[model samples]
Target: MATDDIKDTVEYSEDVKVDEKQNISQHEGIPRPEDLKQDMALQTGEADHELRERERKLLWKIDLRLLPTLSVMYLLASLDRGNIGNARLGGLEADLHLEGNDFYNALSIFYAGYVLCQIPSNLMVKTMRPSRWIGITMTLWGVCSTCMAATKNASGLFAARFFLGCFETGIGPSAPLILSFWYRREEMSSRLAVFLGSSTVAGAFGGALAYAVLGHLQGAQGLSAWRWLFIIEGLPTICLGLLAFVILPDYPASAGKRWLSPEEKELAIQRGASAFNTDTSNFDLRQVKAALLDYKNWLTALVYTGLNAPLASFTSFLPTIVKTLGFTNLQAQLLTIPPYIAACFYLGIMCYLSDKLKQRALFIIIVSMTGTLGYMFLLIGNNVALQYLGACFAAMGLYPLIPLTLSWISNNQLGHSKRAVALAMANTMSQTLSVLGTQIYKTQDAPAYRPGHAICLAFTCLTWGTALVLRYFLKKENASKDKQYGVPGEIDEKHFVGAEDMYDKHPGFRYIL
Candidate 1:
């Protein structure tokens, strides 16, 4: 079946009772119910085609409006966060008087605020207008990031980075939650790949930008090249944040009032209702309790933790790691670009296949093993060429897991509140480990960084193992549901009445394994 046809079938099935009601009311008791059913059957094919066309247009409009704005916001966020690594090579450490472990401490302290704010920031995104909340946070973080250029010592850098993390938590962790509000589970992975893929672009763009700034602008006006890097990268984020308030849409119920027709708005809301348990209160504490208790949340959080340690080490240390491969400072910065570009292509392909197959855990396992192999090469490779190959493998393997795991956790949860908490909870656990990830690549350990490679390798292996166990449990539960429910039929709106409270416990709901 065509993609639009499948979507039409799902929506039609879910709305069958409503269609029946409309059919019966139109008959006005002039005909028997059987006649109404016959008439409805005749009309169904044409109705499906018309609705599918409208829906296809609606999706295109939404994709155009949402994806680019969110992608650019995330790109700026990634640059501000990761540019510190680029700055490090441009003499940030020497100028700031950072010595020994002070540089690592600077890197790790950002996550202190990051970990603390995950749950609260995500909840705020739920309660406040998403545009306002995200815009305000973006502006604040931009300010904090720009201020890093002014830091005269390790203390100043620590304060700047810590605040930057606090504000940035609103963007990185909150984006998937925001996207969940607009998209269905089947549609999420690819959309999220676009959003998360910005970080890869940031990696590539930051390198080229750093090379230019560090080469030509270093001492043009008495500021170091690293300071100029922070200034140049941080200023554009402020402008984009302000623009978000004007461009970013809120929830579908209220979004596009000026643009979407009433029918389109109704369709959007129904789309959200079909995918999520929408009967519950928006901020129910009970949902929070349910999310905290769900074993799936913890299992996925473990997988996230495993991925983040390596992710943290990779993003912050990739330049440094590349530098150790017998390249000059400028050359190291330039060389980091290709791996990220390769990862971007790799991520797009994997995410497309993931969404097309409607599978998450299997792809996650594949990439985790790929990452394991990457680290194995890095750990023991004898030549610089072999080690560089490891870097490409590591980038390819690690980048896609982020969107996959995030969407998987989001896909399985039912209520909005529960999903919000689950997303934040998983990120909270994973980010805590990221603090340790920052410190693993010690300064003294460089020029080989064997222990760092080994630890990351172990974490990737852990990701693979945990994903296997989680998939097993999810498959088993799906089996239990099929047995108890005797296989689910086409969903109808009637099935959702009072079902929000039951969440994933609802008999009609099935985990997407």
Candidate 2:
């Protein structure tokens, strides 16, 4: 069966019904999508090639219109958030006269506002419209980032950091949620990898940008290079935020008046339903409970917190760590580039294979184990080159887990509210841990940060264990559901739009492995 054939021949209805004659194993509950196409071809009275052509065009339009703009938004968000690391090496700490534990406290304080806003910020992505919510938050964070340049002391910097985090909270959780509104689970992992990989690009860019500013712009305007780094990075983000208001579409079904035609919009909604076996429009308290009550959600949150702690700490501290290798500030900035570059390629390959193989847990485990070994090298080795090699391993392993873990939540949960809350909860827990994580690399632990490396290694191992448990419980639940499917009910036609709960609990829905 060709890809286009499935697109052309399958006429997904408003409610997204599958062919009754298709293999409807109540155990798995969902039909093998490929098995339905021939029957669909007979019913729809359209030639496969004709259908394929149209689908190709529609999907291309979506890809072109959505991905690039979103990628840029994410890249800027990352640079704004992670530039603190670059600034540290560029004289930020010294410029503000930060002393004792003040630098670490400044780093950790950002997550205070970050943890508070996670769930509400995501819920607002529903009511405020993704365009408005995302744009508004971006602009606010940019303003806050620019304000960091003016801070004269640790207290002022702490205040700036908290607000920076409060504004940033939306972007991290919201991007995956927005993607969920558009792409199917199978298609999302790679798209998400691309979006997430932008941060790696930002990491590289921040280093180069900081290096350029430090070398050329230092004392140019009676301000330090770190201040200039903040100004240069912050202003553009504000502009990007303005641009998002014009570019980002709302949910596909209602995103009609913009780029998509009425038919295309319907197709987009139907495509979502066909892939997920539920409507994305449904949001409500009950759905929140569904997400909240699922032990799988909490376990996934735990795993995500474990995975995220190391990644977040690494992003904020990598430049400092690399500087310990006897490199000048300039050399340190340049050195940060290779690990980020390595992580970018590593993320692309892992996500490609993950989507192709239709597996998340195994890849997560593989990356987690690689990270564990990297930490071990850092823990035991004193050789500079060997530890640098370990940093590369850690970067590759640690960063890719973010997208995989997010897409895993999308795979496990259905309905808009449930997906939103699940991602929010996981993000919240992870960000909270990130606060504690930042403190792991204290001044006393500097030079090697051995305790930090050890803590990161332990978390990676815990992440692996949690992933195994999550995979097992999901598999077991599917088997139990498969055995107990009773009388069929009439397929519900009404779409739940923040009113009622309807999702994985529906009889015919199946968990995707």
State the C-alpha lDDT per candidate.
0.89, 0.83
Candidate 1 structure quality by residue, lDDT tens digits, 198-229: 99999999999999999999897899989999
Model 1 lDDT-worst window of ten: 7-16
Error of 2 at 427 (Å): 0.5
Model 2 lDDT tens row, 1-513: 654566465444455554569744443444455656656767566675776677678778887877887888888888888888888887887778888889888888899889899999999987788988999999999999999999999999999889989988767889888888788778888988988889899989988988898889889779888898989999998998888888888787777556888878787777766555355454578788889898889999998998888987898889889998789988999899998899899899999999999899989898888888888888887799889988988888788898988998887787788889999999998999998788898777779899999999999999998999988988787777778984334323433232234567655555655
**TM-score computed on alpha carbons, candidate 1:** 0.92
Off by over 4 Å in 2: 1-46, 277-283, 486-502
Best by TM-score: 1
Candidate 2 steric clashes: 3
**TM-scores for candidates 1 onward, in order:** 0.92, 0.88
> In candidate 2, which residue pairs get closer than 3 Å at backbone N, Cα or C atoms, i.e. clash?
8-51, 27-482, 283-498
Error of 1 at 189 (Å): 0.3
Choose the strongest candidate by lDDT.
1
Q: In the order shown, what is each candidate's alpha-carbon RMSD?
A: 7.9, 9.4
